[model samples]
Target: MSKRSNWAVPYLIFLVIFVALPLILIVVYAFQGQDGGFTFKNVTNFFTDGDALNTFAVSIEVAIENTLICLLLGYPAAYILANKDLNKSAVTVILFILPMWINALMRTLATAELFNVLGFSLGKGTLLFGLVYDYLPFMIYPIYNVLLKMDTSYAEAAADLGATPVQVFGKVTLPLSMPGISSGILMVFMPTVSTFAISEFLTNNKIKLFGTIIQENINSSMWNYGAALSLIMLLIIGLTTLLLGGDKENAVEGGTV
Candidate 1:
């Protein structure tokens, strides 16, 4: 064994203290009563409360909607960037990443302002628009990276053999980029599901997401229930990551080893 391996002793201790212990505390506190006795009232409240479930469902829907929108928009942009000519690549990347430098809240307010200028308002779409815009780069970059590595000779060869531009792109480019597309979609979806900041400020708090529920529970004096809700939210993302992680594994295996 090496001395570096011994470092894991401290790392493992830290993990047990921080991650493992807190999870145990959440589980313990989740079952703890007002008088410090063990109880299931918190979990019971979760299942019994229609508002909580409804809010959670809304949050899930927000995540899904934003993810679909990002995929719809990001794919073409990413494709363009990936297949960009030498002169335009740098400019295209800079433009794609321009929004990232601005604060999310600032961008959200800007979106609201722009919408008002057009005689439209963000209102219910506030959170949706914020998330899609904020995470757009995340969706684009991964797919762009995949595209950058693509062998265009395959596309050129296909076109040379009497394939139309649309046919070659639809048949090859899109399918080949599924790995990147899936990666970007999962990246955008995960954070959007748990996002609290944009939703709270932009949606005018009209929308309730998983993160918001956790915030309400904690900030509005629902500690145990908040913790439970947080745990549930964490579980949702964790399970999603696992499922998509399997897809990533398959993609990697298919693409490489």
Candidate 2:
């Protein structure tokens, strides 16, 4: 092998041991019974369990809500940051990314404390707020990078054709930015659906998201069941990623048109 290819040996080993092995174990355990025999009970339980199904539905609902809010908020912020006339300083971009320097747990704790200090009760609202705050940066940076990298000639050409600013954005900028928006949605939506700590901290353990259910089962020594739940979540996330990937490719092709 070439010297450059040799450098990948360590990373390949790490991937097999840490990533591949863990995923294989999850799948193996997911189909195993507590007696260590092969069975389909764990997977069947998830489908038959009303509470698990309800929690999964709730998690999806929350994820969709959070993704929409982040898009609405982040797209404007990204647009402003990318627009040279609106924002010129790199410092402004850094300011938006500064919060990410701190760990998410720390930020969530601070938010919880802030809400407490203001005498606000913790519930669904706080959960949503914490989720959006943590994931908004994920959404913004993707769109910002895309918008910033985009050629301004398209918009300029549209303007020269007597297209209004709004028309230019709608016809040119928006289509070109769809790939970034897809990436941001994928980044924000998947994690929001599967995050446990943020929901726990913000809601004071009142709300039970799908991740919390998986965690609870694992903690209770229901390894097989937990693995099944994890596998389900992994499958859903994988499917979403594939769907978004297709959309991103389509957007790229459309932008070139």
In angstroms, give how far residue 251 of model 2 lies from its true place. Answer: 9.9
User: Worst lDDT window (10 residues) for model 2?
Assistant: 248-257
Report the Cα lDDT for candidate 2. 0.91
**Clashing residue pairs found in predicted model 1:** none
TM-score of 1: 0.83
TM-score of each: 0.83, 0.94
Which candidate should be chosen as best, given TM-score against the real structure?
2
Candidate 1 Cα misplacement greater than 4 A, ranges: 8-18, 101-103, 109-122, 160-162, 249-257
lDDT of 2 by residue, 1-257 (tens): 78999999999999999999999999999999988999999999999999999999999999999999999999999999999999989999998878778899999999999999999999999999999999998888888888988999999999999999999999999998988898888888999989999989999988889999999999999999999999999999999988888876643432331
Model 2 lDDT, residue 222, Cα: 94
